[model samples]
Target: MATIAIVYHSGYGHTAKVAEHVRSGLEAAGAQAKLYTVDAFVDAETGPWDELAAADGIIFGSPTYMGSTSAAMAKFLELTSKAWFTDGWKDKIAAGFTTSGSLAGDKNETLQRFATLASQHAMIWVNFGAKPGYSMSNSDFATVLNRAGHFLGLATQSLNDLPPEQAPDAADLQTAEVFGQRVAEATKRWVRGAA
Candidate 1:
């Protein structure tokens, strides 16, 4: 079976919710999904390096802090240079997701940065395929990328101080689920073709 590892950092549990939705979607798509918090590796005591190395796909997630991923998640990305140098993740499928406080808080930039890191590792990228869900009345909350994004991007919004439970909303989770399934389905096709 294919395995997809979701590695992320959620400062206030918002990103974590998105990760879980993605994981659930992957599982539904017939792949084993594993969730790894950045703290699991950054804590200096508990790390899941081997688990990460064995995955068929990797999805990175984090809250958008100051227009980028959290410092902790960034550090985790930095530490993956060893794997990159060895080309350990060269052919794996990669995707990214981010949650932010505002409607236009540079969330796309954060997702793009994550995608760049994945590209540097020589991995294939996937993106959310949903159209922007905008209405004339609520254009501010509307997104061009919708729940699914473009080129392996997933964007979510959590209004100020409202927990992820309220921000990402059901629509965001639904989008995440679709993204997960798409990634897993693509990975399966690639693996079968390779064989």
Candidate 2:
């Protein structure tokens, strides 16, 4: 069985919710999956980097802050420089997701940044393959092409003062799950072809 690692940082649990859905999707697809929160890496005796290096696929998530990823996630990426030097993630399937507080939040930028980092490590990138809803669909609230990125893109409407727990509705969670399943399926294909 292939292994998939979901690594992310959640400022107020919104991104964490997305990460959980992603993890569920991967597990449901028959892969050995694990969720690693950036918070744990700060002081944990052993971080998830080892697992990440060994996994066949990796998914990254982070909350958008000031048009980018959380500082914690950024730091995590910076730390991966060591792994990059050693080509630890070469040939892995990589994807990214992000959540922001508003429609105009720079969530896409965050995902793009992660995708670029993945490319730097010579990894294959995956994008959300779900068909886009018509512009009139209530779920299609964001602007056209709003979700564009190397991999699955998700947005939540967190109106002022509303927390992510109450902001991202069922639709957002469902999208995340599908994204995860797609990645797992793609990873399986890659592994089979490699063998």
Candidate 3:
């Protein structure tokens, strides 16, 4: 079975909720999934570096802040430079997801940050494979997947006033689950191919 690690920084719990749904999907797909908080990796010498290195895949998650990943997430990415130097994550499958206060929250930039980081470490970056969910006139706005139409990775929206429990809604959560499954399946194939 594939082992995937979800590394994230959820400032207000919205991203954390998305991570949980993603984990559910990964588990459903027969992959072992674990969630790790950015706070635990603030110090390079500390945290579960070994666990991350052992993971077959890693999905990065963070709340979009100022049109990019959160500061905490950025710090974590920066700290990965040590790993980059040693090619610790080379050939591993990598993916990303983000939550924002607005629908078009420049979330792509955050995903780009993740992809670029993965590229720097010689990892394969996975895109959100599902087509846009609200492309048709008859499409239901409330129940469609990939409603925001982001291709680079999963992007979800939440109202600033509403709490995490209610803002992301069922559609976005379900979308995240699907995304997780896709990544897990892809990782499994990639691992088999490598073997």
How does each model score on lDDT?
A: 0.82, 0.77, 0.93
What does candidate 2's lDDT look like per residue over 91-153, in tens digits? 999998888777657677887898899999999988887655434554454433323232345
TM-score, predicted candidate 2 vs. hidden true structure: 0.87
Model 2: lDDT equals 0.77
TM-score ranking of the models: 3, 1, 2
- Candidate 1, residue 152: how far the Cα is off, in Å: 4.4
Candidate 1 lDDT tens digits, 154-191: 88777777876586877777778877888889888877
The residue pairs found clashing in candidate 1 are: 126-152, 127-152, 128-149
**Which has the greatest lDDT?**
3
Compared to the true structure, candidate 1 yields what TM-score? 0.89
Ranked candidates, highest lDDT first: 3, 1, 2
For candidate 3, list the clashing residue pairs, or say none.
Answer: none
Candidate 2: where are CA atoms >4 Å away? 43-46, 137-152
Better of 1 and 3 by lDDT: 3
Per-model TM-score versus the true fold = 0.89, 0.87, 0.98
Please, what are the lDDT tens digits per residue for candidate 3 over residues 11-95?
8999999999999999999999999999889587788999999999999999999999999999999999889888999999999
lDDT of 1 at 167: 68
Candidate 1 vs 3: which has more TM-score: 3
Clash count of each predicted structure = 3, 1, 0
